[model samples]
Target: MTSLLEGLEFEHCDAAAARSIRDTVEDIYRRSYVQAIASGDPFDSPSEFMRRFDSYTDPRNRGFAYVIARVDGKPAGQIWGWSLPENARWWTGLNLDIGDDLEEFTAEDGTRTFGLSEIMVCTEYAGRGVARALHDELLGSRTELRATLLVEADNERAYQRYRAWGWHRIGWLRPGWPDAPKFDVLIRDLDLAVNEK
Candidate 1:
């Protein structure tokens, strides 16, 4: 008997390296979201996804870190994110009712926060812990005060997984894209996480 994780390997990349391997990343994403794409939503299409990937790979997104998981030499999953600039508009459309001032919480000087952009594991690799491995590799070395990510509000499974992994929802956000559904804004304090560990 062989454990799925026994053959797993991880690769870390910067923005330039990530750009160079865009095709592989895109392939993994497509395989991971096959069902979503099958729904006929333009936002879930490969082309639209590439557009977002391009932005994430842009040099302007400083501290961009990408991690890929491989099982038996084949791509299995990926996770990536970057530091948010002071003027970042990531919080613009967030609707928060949590008593805390959103501005103060979101204040960024390119070091205060890390904006996690994407994380996905191919269907064949799901439940094999590849996604969690990629996540830990990418975020474990971050020096930011906290990290934030968006998950589709209705995705109960994913939302619950994130919650169990220490992320808590602070608000809801509807992206500027046409027909974009609302997503829950989840955040995790890196310092606290480290301390608790």
Candidate 2:
């Protein structure tokens, strides 16, 4: 879906568009790292995380999908995700926005849910509806019926933004990432008939 905010288009990554997707994801992570430090805290990058993270486009990496949001005809944001079957612990690993264990929260109606895993908007586009646009497309297009994203507990700006979109806290941060403060996991239930429609 195209956002009404000027020339913005949301597109999923295909094998042919993998390079563009990789570039956007890499930049997204880099900016996120910088943002953490600028705020007077340090955030750890997973060891060799880039190598493993870039495999999303590999055919062998089944069960995962990636998407990028382009604004003014440039890649401005990206979001990616995977499935979560039952009997898994926490569904989403403690990684930023990673969720393979979505069964932890199930609705009475039985539809499954997952995380936004990774939603990053280019720093230049910050405060625009770009993150929402990118994430809305991610959840709106998912085969699973529900989803959300993780936000650091100290990011007042982002905390407010996620709240405005109607997500609520469902979990807390687990230690391991370098200098990452305790985080609050925010979630949105897409199965709500009013919201889903």
Candidate 3:
């Protein structure tokens, strides 16, 4: 489907291609997250941000995807994610209890779920549907039964957007990383009628 935002274009790139355009992605990140950076947020640190991207697109990675959105042929936003592996520790920090069948329920049979890691829209493009375009295109193309993403617990705007996008909050998680803050873990079931339309 065509992006709703006029003059917007979405292009898919693999992990290597994403790494090649790291600077462009970082530029969008810096602009979209200027407020967080000014607030002394460690996750906004340039080095830390780059490290997070590197971890997502590591050389040994087996599954990953990236989409860069352009407005009038200029980069305006980006989104990317990867399939969760059997060894994935993304849920390790979840402060919730699971019954004895936790392992059986959470086992990754290779394409069970996708983990959406990042989405950023340039400040200049805010409120122009760039983010919704990028986000929908990325998630809609995924084959997994469901998708997951973590957003700051207090980000009301983000929470509203996700909720409006048909995502449901599963629980809260505090990443083990020293600089990471408590985040809400949201899940979007791909098999639902809400996403099918």
Candidate 4:
């Protein structure tokens, strides 16, 4: 909540039918990640991004949620995630050495452990508190017991911010996707004081 974000508006959308807002969401994604897309990475292609989004929004997907933030009447950022099913493959690609404790992190029925798929703000609005506002607005009402997100290993700035925000680095994972990179997985308890605000 900074002065720059004072005029921002947030909207929650039904994950299964987000088409009405897809254009605005993709616009923010394209503008915010222009550099990555310019590198000719197939994973960053608009179509590829949409394909993943399509799957995440399927009605059969449990605990799915999507949120958008608009600034000056234009999409400035978005955040979305879904609860991890008991058999979710999220841990299959993990490269961490957690041993038997692995079960401790796996989701089960009624566990409400969500996987934070994406969160980003347009580059022009970086550091203006838009990202935080979007994050807070999305998580504040979540009934999940905990949430997880992955940060690129080299993204020192974001990793630091997540850490400072009370997220703990649990392990690493390399997803089976085109041009995917190993990521440091971070977990944050929904009961954390900051998130409770």
Q: How much does each candidate deviate from the true structure in C-alpha RMSD?
A: 1.8, 5.8, 2.6, 1.9
Q: Whose lDDT is higher: candidate 1's or candidate 4's?
A: 1
Estimated TM-score for each candidate: 0.93, 0.69, 0.90, 0.91
Which of the two, 1 or 2, has more TM-score? 1
Off by over 4 Å in 4: 97-100, 193-196
Tens-digit per-residue lDDT, 73-133, candidate 3: 8888899998888867887756544343546545775599888999898888888778888
| Deviation (Å) of 10 in candidate 3 | 0.9
TM-score for model 2? Answer: 0.69
Better candidate number, 2 or 3, judged by lDDT: 3
Per-candidate clashes come to 0, 5, 0, 0
- Superposed by TM-score, candidate 4 places the C-alpha of residue 86 at a distance from the truth, in angstroms, of 1.7
Worst 10 residues of 1 by lDDT: 188-197
For candidate 2, write residues 69-162 as lDDT tens digits: 7777777777776554344233334443455443434322323656455677777777677877766676676666666566778778878877
Instruction: Give the lowest summed-lDDT range of ten residues in model 4.
Output: 103-112
Off by over 4 Å in 3: 1-4, 97-101, 192-197
lDDT ranking from best to worst?
1, 3, 4, 2
- Superposed on all Cα atoms, model 1 deviates from the true structure by an RMSD in Å of 1.8
- Report the lDDT of model 2 for residue 10: 75
